[model samples]
Target: MRPDELDTALNNLAAEHRLRQRAILHSPQGPHVRIDGRDYLAFASNDYLGLANHPALKTAMQQAIDDWGVGSGASALVAGHFAIQQQAETALAAFTGCEAALLFGSGYAANLGVISSLLGRGDAVFADKLNHASLNDGCLLSRATFRRFRHNDVAHLEQLLRDTPAKTRLIAVDAVYSMDGDEAPLAALLQLAERYDAWLYLDDAHGFGVLGEGRGVLFDHALHHPRVIYMATLGKAAGVAGAFVAASHSVVNWLINSARTYIFTTAHPPAQAAAVLASLQLIKDEGWRRLQLQRHISRRHLQSGVGGCQPAFGLAVLAWRVCR
Candidate 1:
């Protein structure tokens, strides 16, 4: 099809959702931002800790730029991997309690690379109904037999696992449902994974840096066994950009060598990686941020004057939907 035709088709889908509101940001993301050529209250950003424009993070980035000269210049395998990236990856692994962590350009790339590399046509993949589009697209790209289980329903997941008879079974779930603002039953899901000898992939995009003392929903459940693979995005509560997969050393090496996204794509900027490192330290050392976030969410829950609806539970990536 013509490029204009495809653009028109995409526009039609956007119009269907009543999501055509376009706002321009003049400053870095935060609770209060310069939007649409004016300052406004912004609750839509993933900067739950309000650290994107933090002085420390900015200093770290500037220092990295001064030392590293900016761009990575090539893929990680071809000399793009620097000490900054290594430091950030190591910090992420320690934060997530994993033996090793592999960095990717974004959360979508991390999901796609991990899911597709580990599963193929002969595998049976079960995913949460409310999983992010990245997980769904990863399943499709993997050529696996994709099955959707009820969102956060352990019983439905068990039934699906019992029904599928593939040589390899993989279960994918979101630590926190993004749009619905709900959490997955991680303990139960991990139990099922252990019983069925399946690999459990948990995307903690909304939970990391805000849930379970900044460890995430899955970590809160203490599912640190080898069967669980944890994925998280730095762009969220970390107030930076990039994604990572924390798993066993074997899996990390496999992704490093075989995951197309990691192998083929240019490495993330070293400055960004340095900024992420600073953000990681803030998330770990400054426990008050997480506490404040919880209190904010609680305040929304107790608020009865503005809107009768309370904020969603188990996550703090978004504001409560208050319609006036």
Candidate 2:
């Protein structure tokens, strides 16, 4: 393509209001925020439990920095897997009721690592149409026979599963759609996974530290099947940084050994893990935050006159409203 073509595309995007821009925040993350020298009630954050700016997490992070410094200095497989990371992983697995857990630098990395590591040629991946972009990219990277069902349509997924002849099949979905504030039919999906002998991958990035009294959707539904792989992001509801994939011991072990994203990338700062450890404790012990969030969501819905009508998973009904 010519340079003028690129400029024209950029101009078109700007003219169509599709160009993205970053807001300069001058204050910490919370319900209220300061941007570009103006103050506003912010509803765009994923910090559902309002713990991102918690004093406890800040203290823990500072103490961790004092102990472990600011960087891991190496990948986890080399010299970066510090005690803090291990502790955080243990806490995360326990909190999610999974047999094992492996940490990643971010949710996008975690999704890519898990999906790519698990499925490949001769295998098939069935995903919800509205799954996070990371999930779709992971499927594409794996070179698997990628199939997408209608968003949240378990029947379509089942039909696809029945028709697929791949020896190994994996189904991936978001436990709670981040944009729409609606939940997936995890129980139905789990049943289908069991019936079709497929692996179920649940990304609970928006649900962990908020739903099921802070344990998440899988724990709430009691769907701890062996074939289930659970992934949650810490930067969002956990009120920290990084992400993790929780699953059976063997699955986690496989990811640790085979997932290139985890193997090649530098580990997250040990201090962040320390903060996450503190955040997990807060998520478990402090129920009031979740209650407060629910109240706020209810009030917002009422004020918007949207009632309780649920929208399609992962599609935001009100672009500026804080539904997730």
Candidate 3:
């Protein structure tokens, strides 16, 4: 694009009130935060379980920094893998009931790496219309026949699956959509995937620490299948950094070898993994946090009767309010 076109685009966005800016953060992530020289109750964060500022995590991170230094010093395949990261991966795999798990620098990279590695020119990707931008970008990057079905519409997805002639197919979606506070029909989607011989990819960033007794969407629904690939970010409820993909041992192995993002980027700080370990323990022991979250949500959605959400996919999709 030329400079004149870029200027016009910026002017148009400003005129339409669509441009956004970053706010300066002055305090740790929590319900109450300091931003832009003001203290306010914050609901914009993904720290659903509220462990981002926990003392235990701070201590763990500090100790890790002292012991292991700040950086991993290289990529995971190039002597950057550490014992703590391995431990976190093992714990995460067991927690999610997957055969294996692989960590990525962030949720965006994880999605991009997993999707692009699994599908290429000959594969087809059926995604929800409201899927996160990273998922859509990954599909485009994979050079696949990307088909977007209506959000939560199983029939639309099924129709697309029936029409697609690609050999390898993938169905990708968010387990719990943050904007709507509604969950995907994992069981129904799994059925469709099995029927079409397509793999299902679930991004559970918002569901991990808040749903399924802090285990995630799979346990909440009691749904599991060999054709499912699950990914979640620790920065949300896990209260740290990095994302993990949990799937069959074979899939994990393939990602390790083929995912360009994972192979090229420097490993995330090992200290973050230590913080994640600390966060995991808190999530496991603290049942009241989940109850508190439920209570907070109920007051706004169930009691107030304001901003209620509608059902989708022939099932009740719960509404979620952004702020308290």
Best by TM-score: 2
Q: Tens digits of per-residue lDDT for model 2 on 1-324?
A: 797699899889999999988989999987678999999877567676778899999999999999999989999999999999999889889998989899999989999999899898999999998898999999999999999999999999999999999999999999887667678899899899999999999998888877788998878899888999999999887888889999899999999999999999899999999999999989888898777666666665666677556442222212222443
Considering TM-score, where higher is better, how would the candidates rank from best to worst?
2, 3, 1
Q: Model 3: residues >4 Å from true position, as ranges?
A: 303-324
Looking at model 2, the pairs that clash are none
Question: Which lDDT values do the candidates have, in the order given?
Answer: 0.84, 0.86, 0.85
TM per prediction: 0.91, 0.94, 0.93
Per-residue alpha-carbon lDDT of candidate 1 for residues 1-324, written as tens digits (9 for 90 to 100): 787797787778787974466777897866566877888766577777778888989999999999997889999999999998999889888888899998899999999999999999989999998889999999999999999998778998999999888979899998877775667888888889989989999999988888778877656878798888999998878888989999999989999988998999899899998998899889889998877777777766665243433344423434421210
- Clash pairs (backbone) in predicted model 3: none
Specify the highest-lDDT model's number. Answer: 2
Q: Model 2: which ten-residue window has the lowest total lDDT?
A: 312-321
Whose lDDT is higher: candidate 2's or candidate 3's?
A: 2
Tens digits of per-residue lDDT for model 3, 1-324: 787799898888999999887899999986577899999767566676678888999999999999999989999999999999999889888888888999999989999999999999989999999898989999999999999999999999999999999999999999987666678889999999989999999999888877888989878887667899999999877878889999889999999999999999899999988998899899999988778667666655655465646222111111121332
